[model samples]
Target: MTRSEATPLTIAYTATSAEPGVNIAALTDALTHHANSALFPGDGEVTLVVQGRAPVTFDLTPMRGDQIEADMHKKAEQINDQLNHMLAEVAAHSEILEASTNGLDVLGVYDQAIAATPQGGEIVMVTSGLSTTDPVDLDAAGDWQLNPSGFVAQINPRDIPDAQGRSITWTGLGQTSTSHAAGTTDPTSTRARPNSQQANKKLHTQHAPGPAARQALHDLWLNLCETSGASSCTIDDSLLPATPTTATNRVPVIEFDQVTTNCLGTFTLAADIAFSPNSADLTQAADKLLAPIADALATCPDGRRINAYGHTAEVPGSGDGIGLSTARATNVLARLQQLGAPRNTIGIPTGYGDTRPTVDNTPNGAYREDLARLNRTVELTITN
Candidate 1:
């Protein structure tokens, strides 16, 4: 299959002293997984925003891909190299300014990144999700109660541009760290103590938020992204595991028909192959159709739930239509779990049956096969 051109990508990253510092190595791993995930298009421009004392931007020219290759080999490598150099700069500067954090700088960076891409694009923010500076101080006492709606309301409208239907992803929230310098451990021997004790004391400290706090942060960002008119918002607080270099440039495996601003993803499967005739058993072709849906569900961040609803056409003589529909919904849920979707994130499956059809099954006393086909579907909605 011929591939279409990829949309441009913008990444905004910050590691400040107010919260735990970001692990550069882990970030590298995440970026590699992201780039290889095929979510980014080839021959697309890349914009990097590093938030330090201020927001610093780096806009790389588009890197064209080879037409003969199925994946973005040349483009991914070039983008990775360019981004790595920029991330190195962020790391070096972060070390120098470890005592202070300008968390508010991310708003300006978001504005700049969004304004730069008027047509549309994807924007990724990697930060602790805690802002210590003015405008919005998440770290301040009594601010923990701030919800997404309240947070967005307090922000200056002029500071953040409308997302214009762009995709926004916020990750690495609440991942904080600390580091201590080497110190003495011996009561005597004033010569700076033993090397072994000193070395162990200088370890890096990593801290993750409790489940409640993590959920609050996720909700705040998810709300902000949606309020900004983003087409979709994906917030995953967990640190991405290290992936092998061999997996760095693979094609994206998941695609959806549409993902609303509310993060509701709808996938209309092919009715002919969705299930066996008059039975709950899914056909082999249904596996291919549902695979991407499972992948999409897996990306949902914590504190959110996935609710799947099954709908079927109106079969006049079909006995137990509701039972069949419910059974199909249950099977779909089970298949999704088998396909790697988190069981905790999925809610109980629901069957709408023929009670709610997308189109008229028998318009003017004539059965419409096309209309009925459109009604056979499973809708997945994500909510906080």
Candidate 2:
């Protein structure tokens, strides 16, 4: 019923299915679900990544729990706080996945095991899985060892998965400034964020952040998870300048426009939209469709403004596709404010009914669902 302090680990996430715009609350929920469902004997970290967006990570340190009242008085409260904080962040990640992810496919989940420095010796993989009988004990045949040379004579390093069930495939092997490959160096002393996304599927990675950037992002995640609608909230200690600058502290919002790392444009939604019976009335479940739009708002709050555009192709349906498209646009816009988008930032809804089609929608005995679906998307564009 107790855990050792040496089992500290970090869990990070990257969301590629949805656009960068997202509410921290959604990420918090997703991460919470992931952590709760995850099998861990001790504490760890959690993160969220969106395509073309800045990543968010949370470090949940381990806490020792004892039945003794005195022990509970000192560690339980703080430990509870840490757990609650992690749950919030994790839940946010789950929200994006469940609601807006296009294909339910993720880049990867990067996990780095943290071990107590040996008594001046090389570090080895630290986990309970080394023992055939007891997978959670570190005193196994080859556990509690950090092979500085990245060579494990007793076990095939390729076969070993981290605390989470993530493996390090050949494609995932690399030492970059952003992420560190497993066992390449003692993680206790080094900080690396290797490419954990979609690298052969055996393992995942995270963006390596410097000490300051890590701290800054950590604070941003906490503020986003803790405060409700923190549009005007500020953190850290920096005065508002006479003129505006990036350094000014305000509630963190999505900046998809300037996150040039991805430089995404005209992002498209998935094909799971739920329209009411022959009408553009978004069903109750259709609320999920707005999640990505909300994410865009949060991801690029200060970048360039956007217009929520709805489109439809001329097809055989009960109602006029143009009217349906217009209805979809209006409904989507009505929910934008609720999603945390700044009022002046998101433009009014516009519908392009077959007027603008990604593919030729001409009535030449050639109307396909795939082409029509592309035209039926609820997309975002920079305001003119």
Q: Model 2, residue 349: displacement in angstroms?
A: 1.5
Candidate 1 residue lDDT tens string, 1-384:
233434657666554432334444555654554444443334334455655333345433223453322446675666577667767775676543232232334455566667655445678777666554445455442333323455567777665569976888787666553332112233444444222234344322224443334444665667677777888888643454322110000111111222212234333443456788667888997776567657766776776666667777886676436777788778877887899888886777788888886556767777666456656666555566
Off by over 4 Å in 2: 1-265, 270-274, 283-289, 295-304, 316-320, 361-363, 382-384
Clashing pairs in 1: 6-41, 20-176, 20-177
lDDT of each: 0.54, 0.35
Q: Candidate 2's residue-wise lDDT over 225-318, tens digit each?
A: 1221211222211111111011101111111111111112343332234455446666665455455545556666365566656677657653
Alpha-carbon lDDT of model 1 = 0.54
Q: Candidate 2: deviation at residue 114, Å?
A: 48
